[model samples]
Target: MLALLRPALWLGSCLRGYHMHAASTQQRGDTSLVLVDEARRFIQDCLLRVGVSPSKVRCISEFLVVADYRGNYGSGLNRLDYYLSDLQSGHAKVGAEPSIISETVSTAHVNGNSALGVFVGNFCMDLAVKKAEDSGIGFVVAQQSHDIGMASWFTFRAAGKGLAGIVMSNSAPTMMGPNSKSASIGSNCFAFCVKGEEYHFVLDMATSVKDIGAVEWAWANDEYIPHGWAANEGGLSTCFPSLALRTPLLFPAGGHKGYCLSAVIDILCGVLSGAQYATHITMDQNQPSNLGQVFIALDPEFFLPNFMERFDDFCGRIQNSQPADDSEPIRLPGELERMHMNYVEDLRAFAYPNSLLTKYKEVAERLCVKPIELAFDRCQSRKSF
Candidate 1:
């Protein structure tokens, strides 16, 4: 069992470390540090102007802000354009709500009615957590939702309530499946979070060697991704971001194993939820993605005594493990994201790439909303520029 778990453990460290470097160039130039409150308000105002409901803006803005705050820039406000475009194009329904199609004590199936991903995800996950609170476990699935940002957002929500959280989503197809010559599955990302006495353990990742956002970022920044991240339609590895983005047949991480896992996620989120699957789902702004997602929550207190005590002991053993690198210590699943979130909070300002900031301003202007207010001067309490 330990051996089987080693790859996942290693991947958690490697993915988090790689994200720091991959998104490093995105931290400087054309960027401004703004108070977190300012950022949240900016997003809320923009969404409001773009026809999002007043009641929904807070939840959506906070979700995106948390993504940026956690250093997951790919799924952060950088993705705001996608949402705006979808809503503008009528791909996502404005002021829409999901309806429960079927339900039991601990499970539910919902139809999002083409609502924005953030709203559907929040609604469904909150329902799942409430059910877990009442019944000790909950499972919820939804269809016809747009992009849900990061899966961890939902898992962390449950974790915040002292319950174990698990989430999975099937995105539009961009991954090359095992033994196939073309794209056959979505990136099929997933997140799992466990509540501990001190910190929550979160393992959130896509099953791809690299998500499409990485390729898009590389294209935008004129950078090159390392080999094995993507391939051409002919199935040949390529480092050219243009080709990778144009013909995004991304490699599955861990080869066949990752491919298999992605397929299973699609089964649960797509097939089981009765949402669009495989090539039928499109990521283009001209069409609704019709994404599917599942959220599960389990209350440990209902199952065992000393759950937190056991969690702490289990995590302590991993943290105390010998480190092969002198500069880096072993970390638990969600520790890296938690540490980054804290680091950003400690600074009291979040940094974004100049390009993304510019795009945000452009979108705000297009929507007839005021430009985002950026904090321009540095202070003893927080850094800005």
Candidate 2:
């Protein structure tokens, strides 16, 4: 398998950014949680080590923390090594700004020019939201970026601004179609967000039963991955993540229906954006991945009256439904994520598993940055959504 996360050969090439002088006493404590402020510092410092500017680092790091805050563990700090590897290989450029290729009142085509994926994602989302506010809807296609990570950050940004938001990203394919084994289409992911008067509706999902990242986490932690999420090297079903990563094929979410839907998403994000799709997207670590992303935002007020109230009503109805188990309460989508964020807010820290703490320490050492200060506390780690 052509794993993008493989360690880069040119590790010293992208290490010229960031400032001199260090934060002393940064790595002194052992802790159960990483605070919001501490996580930001750690992220910023890591990005700086990779030659990202201070200003750009600020924007990029926030969403990474937000992913952890909202319990999207895969897209959070756990994925930092993948991104730094992209930079170290000189594929993901530092300080390259997104360029608009063409634009109409409500639509746009952009070339990210190999910028940081988060920077490109934010640039597209901001433009989409502005256009939506002006013209009732906006659709933007962006190319030459990879791994935007946690699309909900962009989707929820638009939803917070009174717009219905949709974000989709295409990846180098690892999914297998019905007949072919090996690897085929991408494990494409999308995120949708809309606002209710009382709640935010967030549906962020990969077309696969579970993303490869979750499977990897299971492998590293020696936890059991549920059946049907992945397959072993021979392309047969397996709950073992270690064996699954040997070949790295994830099962489709809805069997045939999911395979087709994933293809359509590849069309929207890849083909429609004039980039590669499916097996065509590059996997070579030393070159730009040239993946494409799409963002669409719509002003709900333009098409419907009492939109928030109606959405809230639907959320209420869903939550009020009878549960299969008497003790477990039915919750709306994004509810548990909200609860997790609230938990962090209440504690003013992230009580992550010990593995993450170890990962953080490793990343800090590798990047030559101060590790995030963690103060030990004895508490059960909350299940990440």
Q: Which candidate should be chosen as best, given lDDT against the real structure?
A: 1
Error of 2 at 217 (Å): 1.7
Off by over 4 Å in 2: 1-32, 353-356, 377-385
For candidate 2, report its TM-score.
Answer: 0.86
lDDT of each: 0.78, 0.77
Can you write out model 1's per-residue Cα lDDT over 72-125, one digit (the tens) per residue? 767877787887778888889887789999999999999998898877888898
Best candidate, TM-score: 1
Lowest summed lDDT window (length 10), candidate 1: 1-10
Name the lDDT of candidate 1: 0.78
